[model samples]
Target: MSSAFLPGFFLGFSLILAIGAQNAFVLRQGLRRQHVFWTCLTCALSDAVLIAVGVAGFGHLAMLAPWLDLAMRLGGAAFLICYGGLALRNAWRGGAALHAGGGDGSTLLATLLSVLTFTWLNPHVYLDTVVLIGSISAQYSDRLAFGLGAVCASFTFFFGLGYGARLLAPFFGRPRAWQVLDGLIGLTMWAIAAKLLVM
Candidate 1:
């Protein structure tokens, strides 16, 4: 189990380093400096829960209920499409210039709900954190250590990303920068949704 720790940490980084919908949302929230701590914590904890489930050998649940994949795919695609459209609209409007100590005026509940939706509703998250991680952990004698390492990686990455975004505060002061960011995020979301549909 101890030997698997490093492998798990690196694997976790490899899997989550991609700029997916969830990551995009986190980046956006981080850049906005809105609910950074809670956002990062929620993402980390969500990954931890899924990792634990995977390490516990619950990956077979997907096999036991194949329909679950299709259901999640459809639901996820729908939500992504809607969210992507909203983002694109925001981009087109060209507002949302960043101000010091100011936020987008969203409530904490709304922010959490958005992050949770981005994390839990996305089928790819389950694929990466549960199925893939679970299957890989099975190869090791110390699955618990491997899972813990992956969990730690998750916590580290989320907090680092959420806080590290502040470094770009100077750049985001321009409204055009926010527009470009929103445009990219919208396109990314739509692309993921399209992939989900095709899958």
Candidate 2:
């Protein structure tokens, strides 16, 4: 059980650590200090549910739905491209900064909705949390332990990122820092979108 848990933990962490739309949004909201706790909680809980479903063998159901893949890929690509464009526009505007006060602040409901979209609309999340992780868990006799480990990884990561972003507030105080961050985020979105299109 311990052995299964460790591998699941590391694998889950490695997968989530990669820079993507979900992580980018979480980090941005975290830095802004807007509903960080709820945002992180939603993300972590969503992952927990998906991970549980995967372990319960719903991954095979996902595999059977070839059309779902096409729909998700198209939707995800469009969403990423649109988001990337917005980020680039924000960068070009050159006045954005991470501050407690407003400069495009959103309500909690809106923020959570966006977070949900970023998490669920992105096909990669399904691929990673469901198909890949689920398929791998079959190899272990202690699949429940492995799934729990993955859930732990999700909680650790989302909470850490959401809360930890505050530490970078000082650096993000400058407009230039925001520009750089937004630019990088834009590039990441486009890159991922390209990958999705190609795949």
Candidate 3:
């Protein structure tokens, strides 16, 4: 169990470290420095919820079903194709042009909606955090430690992206940096989706 913890956390983090819509959104929020806490909080809490659900709901299925991986890969690929297209379009049209009306109320609402968009609409997020990570944990047959590791990893992601971003502020502070980052994320999503589909 103790050994499973490190492997589980590393597994979860490795899958999640890739570029995707959720990471794009979180990076945007971190760079904008607007409602950073709310955005990161929503992301972390949402992942925890989904991780729990996947562990509880699909725990048995992960071990029993062989086609499950195939279905998930295809589903994730389809979703990623769609999401990547939208993200690329957004990058071309400017997805980072957020201005929170210069009021506390507007900031809160905007932040909430932004996080909701990331939480609900991002397919990569669902696939990686909900499906892949959960499935991996379920493979252990004893996910009590793996589940906790996954939870810890989820929080670690938010903190790493939010707080650690301060170090990159000088570089990412530019609009061009956002464009490049968003564009790269979109491209990476497509490439990975294609890889999964082919495999």
By how many angstroms RMSD does model 1 differ from the true structure? 1.4
| Model 2 lDDT tens row, 1-199 | 5789988898899999988999998898887788889999999998988888888888989767789998988898998999999999888887734443243668899989988988998888988898888989999999999999999999999999989988888888888888888899999999999999999
Candidate 2 has a TM-score of 0.94
Candidate 3: which stretches are off by over 4 Å?
A: 59-106, 173-175, 182-199
TM-score of each: 0.96, 0.94, 0.66
How much is 94 displaced in model 1, in angstroms? 0.9
Worst 10 residues of 1 by lDDT: 95-104
lDDT (Cα atoms) of all candidates against the true structure: 0.89, 0.87, 0.69
The number of the candidate with the highest TM-score is 1
Query: Against the true structure, whose lDDT is highest?
Result: 1
Which of the predicted structures, 2 or 3, would earn the higher TM-score when compared with the native? Answer: 2
Q: List all candidate RMSDs to the true structure.
A: 1.4, 1.6, 5.2
Give each model's clash number.
Answer: 1, 0, 0
lDDT of 1 at 68: 90
Tens digits of per-residue lDDT, candidate 3, 69-141, equal 7776776677667767866775687534522211124377776775676566545556666677777776776
Stretches of model 2 off by over 4 angstroms after superposition:
96-103
